[model samples]
Target: MTGKKKHSEGEIETVAPAAMGTAEWQAEFLTQRRLDKARISARFAGKTLDNFSARDKGRKMLVHSAQTYVSGFNLNKEAGGFPVYPKGLLMTGPVGCGKSHLATAILRGVIEKGYSGLYYNSPDLLRDIRATFQPDSDLTEDDLLEEVTTVDLLVFDDVGAENATGFVLDRFYLIINERYEGCKPIIVTTNLNLEELENRLGKRILSRMLEMCEIFGPFPEEDWRRRNLR
Candidate 1:
C-alpha cells in the first residue's frame, strides 16, 4: 500500500507504507527460513562485519569492501520489473585468511535485510546433491538446484576443495550457469589460486565467475588459525 504525504513546501509525495499484518508476518517467516537455509555453522554464526577483526590495513580494506557490497544491495530492485544482475564477490586467498568469515558475514547481512540467502561449503553441497540420487532420499536434485538458483544470494565456500570428478564438474557447472543465466548473485570463498582453481573447476566456470563477481585478493599469506594456536 502507498500513502500521500504533504510537505511543508506544499508538495505531495507518495510513499510505500511499511508492511503490516499478514504481510509483515510472512516477510519475517521467509526471512527466518532463509537464515536457516544459510546453514552457517556455529563457528561462523556470530560472524558479522561489525565483529570481524580487521587489525591490519589489508584486512580493514576487505571489511570495507564487504560492508559496501552489503550496503549497495537493493532488495526492491531485485524484486522489481527490470532484470537486475547483481554483482557478486569472489574471495580467494591462502588457508585461514578469513575468506569464509567475510563471506558468512556478508550472507548474514543480506539475509537480515529480508533478501533470501543460502550458504554451502562446496564439498558439502556436492555431497548433498549426490545423495539425492539415493532412492529413499527426501530431496531431489531439482529441489536443491531450484533453491540455489532462485535464492537472492548464495555463499559458496571452499570452491576448489571438492573432488573434481565428471559428476562434480557437471553439477557444479549447472548450478553456476543457472545462477549466471538468471542474473542472481553469488559469494564464493576459496583457498585455491587462479591456476589451481581453473584446473579444478575448469575454464568455463572460472570465466563465468570472473564476469559475474568482483574478485577480492590473495589475502595475507600468514595462516590466522595457526597463529591463533601459537
Candidate 2:
C-alpha cells in the first residue's frame, strides 16, 4: 500500500510505502525486534557513538567512515552466507588513538541490527581465562571459549598488548581458529602495524586475520584522549 499525506492545498501526497494487514503485522514485528535489539546492545556496549570523543576533524571523519559500515550491515545476508562475510574491520594505531572507541561503536551498530556481539580487552580476556584454572573460580575454560567463539561478532581490543606467553598464544590461537573455521566475523584493534603484528602474532594467525579483515590505519595523530582533555 502507498501511504499519503495531505498537502496544504488539500491534495494527496505520496509519503511512503505503507504496510496493511499481514504486511502491517510484519512491520510491527520488525519494529519490536529492532527496539529489543537496541536495548540488548546498550547492555553489551557501555559506550556509544554519543560518548566517543573525536580529537580532531580528521579523526571525526574516520569515525564517520566506520559508522557507515555499521549502518549498512545486513544480518540476513551475513548469516545466510555464514563464514564468508565481507571483511570485518581491523583498526591499528598507536595507544589512545580511539581504536577501541570506534571498534566498539561499530559493534554496537551491528548489535542494534539484532545481531549479538561481544567486546573484550585482550589482556582482561586472558586474565579471566587464567582465573578459570583456579579451583575457586566459577567459570570454566570451555565456558569462556564457547561464548567468544559463538558470538555474532567478537571485538578484540588491544590485540598486541598482551604478554604473548606460550600459554597465552595457545589460547588466542584457539579463539581465532574457532572463529575462522566457523566463518564468524571479528573486529580487532591493535597498536601494532602489519609488520609488528605479523611478528607478534606469527605468520599463520596474521595471514588469517589479514584475509578476514580490512585494515584501517595507524591514524598517525596525537592521542585522542589527550586531545579530548583540552
Candidate 3:
C-alpha cells in the first residue's frame, strides 16, 4: 500500500464519492466553505490596525494596548503545566477615543494568525438579529447566537451604544454568557464606563466580563476623532 500500483497509472478514476449524494455531507461542506470565505474576507476588510494612525498620544496609547494584547496572546499556552484559556480585553471610554480602531486592529490581526474573529457594532448587531424575524428571513435566532458564541475572538464594538431594551439586553447577554462560560475571548469597546455598563447590562453580566477581560481605558481626555475633523 506504500507504493502506487504500476498497472493503474494509466487509468482515470471517474467515480463520484458516495458522500456526494448525501444531504448531510453537502450541507456540512457548504457550511465549511462559507466559514472559510468569511475568514478570508475578514482578513481583508477595512479599519484594521494597519490603517489606524499612531500620530496622536491617545491613539498611540490605544495602539500600544492592542499591540500588548496581540503580542502576549498564545492560544495554547499552559498554566502550571496545564492548558489554560486566554482572557480577553475590555475597552471602555468616551466617544472618539480610537476604541473601535484598536479593537478592529486586534480582531484583524487574530484572524490573520489563523484564529477566527469577528467585529460587530453592537447596535447594528442587534438590528440584524431583529431583522431575521421577518417572514422571509433565513437565519434563526440560534444560528446567530452560535456564530457570536463560537468565534475565537469577538470584537463587540460600542457595547452600550444601543438602547438597552429588555429584548436587546437579553440577546446580548445570551451571547456574552455563552462565550464567558466556554472560555472564549471577547474584545469589547464601549462608550459607557463600567458603572454605566453595570447599570445597563446589570451586575451579573458585568461581573462575568470582569472575570473574563482585562479592563482598559477611559481615556476620557483623548478625542482623536475631533483632531481629524476637516
The CA lDDT at 131 in model 1 is: 94
TM-score of each: 0.83, 0.73, 0.76
Residue-level lDDT tens digits of model 2 in 55-119: 66766777777778787665355456562364677898888777777787787777666677777
Query: Which residue window of length 10 is worst by lDDT in model 3?
Result: 35-44
For model 1, give the RMSD to the true fold: 9.9
Q: Scored by Cα lDDT, where does model 1 land?
A: 0.86
Q: How do the residues 197-219 of candidate 1 rate in per-residue lDDT, one tens digit apiece?
A: 99899999999988889887547
Clashing pairs in 2: 83-183
Candidate 3 ranges beyond 4 A from true positions: 1-44, 55-58, 218-220, 228-230
Candidate 2 stretches greater than 4 Å from native: 1-46, 51-57, 78-84, 218-220, 228-230
Query: Which stretches in model 1 have alpha-carbon errors above 4 Å?
Result: 1-30, 75-82, 228-230
Q: Pick the candidate with the highest TM-score.
A: 1
**Candidate No. with top lDDT:** 1
Q: Candidates ranked by lDDT, best first? A: 1, 3, 2
State the lDDT of candidate 3 residue by residue for 1-230, as single tens digits: 02233347586546666677588776666555444544323433566666778776766776777777887766788889986887898988777777776777687666655577777888878987998898888998778878889988888888988998989888888988999888999888888778999999998789988899998764645676687674
Model 3 root mean square deviation, Cα atoms: 8.1
Query: Which 10 residues in a row give candidate 1 its minimum summed lDDT?
Result: 75-84
**TM-score rank order:** 1, 3, 2
